[model samples]
Target: MTAPFPPSRPSPTTLIGGHVLVAGGLATGGLKYAADIEAEVVQVFVTNPRGWALTDGKPSEDTALRESPLPVFIHTPYLVNVGSPNAEVLEKSLGSIRHALRRGVEVGALGVVVHTGSSVTQSREDALRQIHDHLLPVLDEIPDDGPDLLLEPMAGQANMLCATVQDLGPYLETLEFHPRANVCLDTCHAFAAGHDLAAPGGVKAMMDALHAIAPGRLKLLHANDSKDPCGSGRDRHENIGAGLIGAAAFGELLGHPAAAGIPLCIETPGKVEGHRNDILLLKRLRDELA
Candidate 1:
């Protein structure tokens, strides 16, 4: 029998989880993977993350996830770039997102994460316009009960349309501040984008900035450590506590008021064992504060 689902809204306490690769499928392998890691929440890709091929979930797997006690989330394929200048790339990106959203609803996901894309070969203004024109209709079509569209800002890579927490202001305004358009702050990305999460009171300061810029829109957090230095613009992720963003900073992150009810999912390295250790550390940090 499937387990009961978690609460629809944010919980009073934070939930910790990792991105589970369901190579054996959600019901058969994914659920077991989550259990192995002792995850309180879960994130999965509904299709090939690096490819444009759209695949459907198994009915059994869908039902199992829909009823699972853990709150579920979907990370749209990496190929999705709604801000692309090329028409074909743009079309495929939108199609991939729509598919992810539909599958997210099928699996009772609470949020769907998509990267804030870059403005390749075009001015940032033109790219934002493209995103506004094409992506708004897609956002409008989401059902009331469907998962939220969580826009994760990128590391401050060259030409990225959205990198820092402040960049979200313009992006959301371009979307006319749609109710479904929410934020998913990634620690590694934020640090790489120059948030200085490793410094004293850095996490709290970043959280304060986020709340000021986009109040009540932070629905998810990607707790990751950077393999590169601050402001490096690199996206390489290292295992928790082993990289630049140190374990202490994560404790601060857990204690931040703005992060109290948010669910944090690690996208760090070291598969199952690494994820298990990371989750345990985060839980310990959270418990100590509690």
Candidate 2:
């Protein structure tokens, strides 16, 4: 189905923002929260991030976000695991994705971020086949004007379907590389998955690998620092400069050609002040590189 409202594509510049809290609603609270952090782009969850229940967001809040100048993206619930071996889990995952996509159109969101899930108790081949069977139809239903389904590879956790940039090759292949099948590169996840973004040239190498794996598929970035060491397989997030990924790596990320024009949204720790500082630091890095 065609998206009733197609979001405008973001310009070719590094737009920095954070995942703003929406406890106060998107308009009454979320927009102000983003403003206080001076966010240039925004990521939000239309429904509870951890719950399976879908919500019809307040019309005023939806309208507020749709009309707002900043680019918007929606992150699906953490429970969504399309690659799961359980039938009930797979069904719920697909439903959640559809809900997020619908809400993305309602809010003029550019993309809907969904984690590349695990394949618990099943072989990798079986999980991929299941994903292809279920996910392809969802992708096929998304209209050209609808939000892109941005698959976020996780930290190198056990049984993860996609973690490294190279892994995205098969994952995208499973989805047939649909136009709307894009990627969201999270720095901490990449570091945990053993990309070593903190090392010299590491960020560039990762970007190069992504380009080689799925050219032009990167649509969003989660600019975060890893609380654990590279290859730790931990998903802990830290303030930009305070973690293992470090601030300099972000500078390299901003300078990289592949990252240009993509919106960078911080999922780092600390609510307001921490996010504000992270955004400022990234902006500084982006400016210095420019």
lDDT of 1 at 63: 97
Write model 2 residue lDDT over 238-265, tens digit each, in one string. Answer: 9999998888999888877777788899
User: Which sections of candidate 2 miss by over 4 Å?
Assistant: 1-13
Local accuracy of candidate 1 as per-residue lDDT tens digits, 95-178 = 999999999889999999999999989999999999999989989999999999999999999999999998999999999999
Least well predicted 10-residue stretch by lDDT in candidate 2: 1-10
TM-score of each: 0.95, 0.95
Candidate 1: give the clashing pairs: none
Q: lDDT of all the models against the reference?
A: 0.90, 0.90
RMSD of each: 5.6, 5.2
The C-alpha stretches of model 1 lying farther than 4 A from their native spots are 1-12
Give the backbone clash total of model 2.
Answer: 0
User: What's model 1's TM-score?
Assistant: 0.95
Model 2 error, position 190 (Å):
0.3
